[model samples]
Target: MNHRQSGSMDSVTIAFELMRLELGAEVDNLNAYGASLFHESQYEEATKLGERGKALRGFLEKVQLLEAEWVNSFAGTAEVDYQDPAVEAATRQILSNSKSPKTALLVRYPCGEVVAEKKGADTLIEVIKRAGAERVAKLGILVNSENIVSRTPSKKYNEARVPPHFIKTHSSTAQKKRNIEQISDALGLGLTVEIIS
Candidate 1:
């Protein structure tokens, strides 16, 4: 869908959540309220509410279909498999087994400040700039507030540190891949999604 449709969907999603929280499973109350309005001679408002109920039901069906599609997308993940000799060797070394194995993300980051390279520097340079910004935010080195890295250190701000529990929780290869991609994108880290076995 286009950006406008996507934004409108997001608004509808929020509205759906809010309505769920307030009304719970009593969604039939909307129709009841519309009936009450009709009895009170407010035909226009009742018609509007009835039309809105229909629209809400339609949106819910669309959301359910999207959810089903997303779930089905993970059914065949063999497409992510890469059968390179180097990757196989690495996988064998990591797992110590050639029969069954799992894939892990290998991230490579610059030791210190990232300096621009002369050739093919566009993407790397942009990543470097983002990495610098991320580091600054993490350290709070140039901040005007009291939550600096020196005192009241928070794990949330540490871009370089990936929580072990997060990796453990996201056990699926696809989930791990997405998580690593998000981390790599957020921190501008170089990553190799060594799709093994």
Candidate 2:
């Protein structure tokens, strides 16, 4: 389907379409094979085939859950339509298990910047590496203030030298700051990193 048409469809429809396109055929094939095995009285083989079918169903369920979460999170506040090419691409990436840094998902801001949801320290880094400096500079990055909270202790400070809370909060903040700086340096286009709540 064209990008525009795909976006026009509601989230549930899109999820079903993706399942039909990507998994429906495999499911049908498995069921057919399993049925044949059952007819032949090959109980073990049929059971194995059923197991495979169950695994595929589990995968589909995961996709559906992720789609629902995505829809819930972005359906209302999104700047660009959910059916935009960028959002579609990101959805495909997520479904295909190609999402870099795992936790991040792509989101487009009102100013026409496509950024990944702030995840870990490597979220922006992965985006930069995947799209490259120029492309990423154009797309931009959004960093959440909450994600900047320090979670790891600094190497320079021991538990005895500072409170654990200080290490987690202050050190994590420093690490996030360094991550942003590194991302800026890698992009080399005076890349502006938008800090959001």
Which regions of candidate 2 fall more than 4 Å away from where they truly are? Answer: 1-20, 79-197
Candidate 2 per-residue lDDT, tens place, 42-138, comes to: 9999999999988986775576566556666654344433335676567655544421221222333335666655543344444345444344334
lDDT of 1 by residue, 1-197 (tens): 45455444434443443333223122234555666688899999989998986776566546545544543453222232333456435533433221222222233455544322322112222432444434523533221122221323433222222221111221223223344455466556665432222
**Predicted structure with the largest lDDT when compared to the true one:** 2
Question: Global lDDT for candidate 2?
Answer: 0.45
| Candidate 1, residue 92: lDDT | 31
How far is each candidate from the true structure, as Cα RMSD in Å? Answer: 22.8, 19.2
> What is the lDDT of every predicted structure here?
0.39, 0.45
Candidate 2 minimal-lDDT segment of 10 residues: 159-168
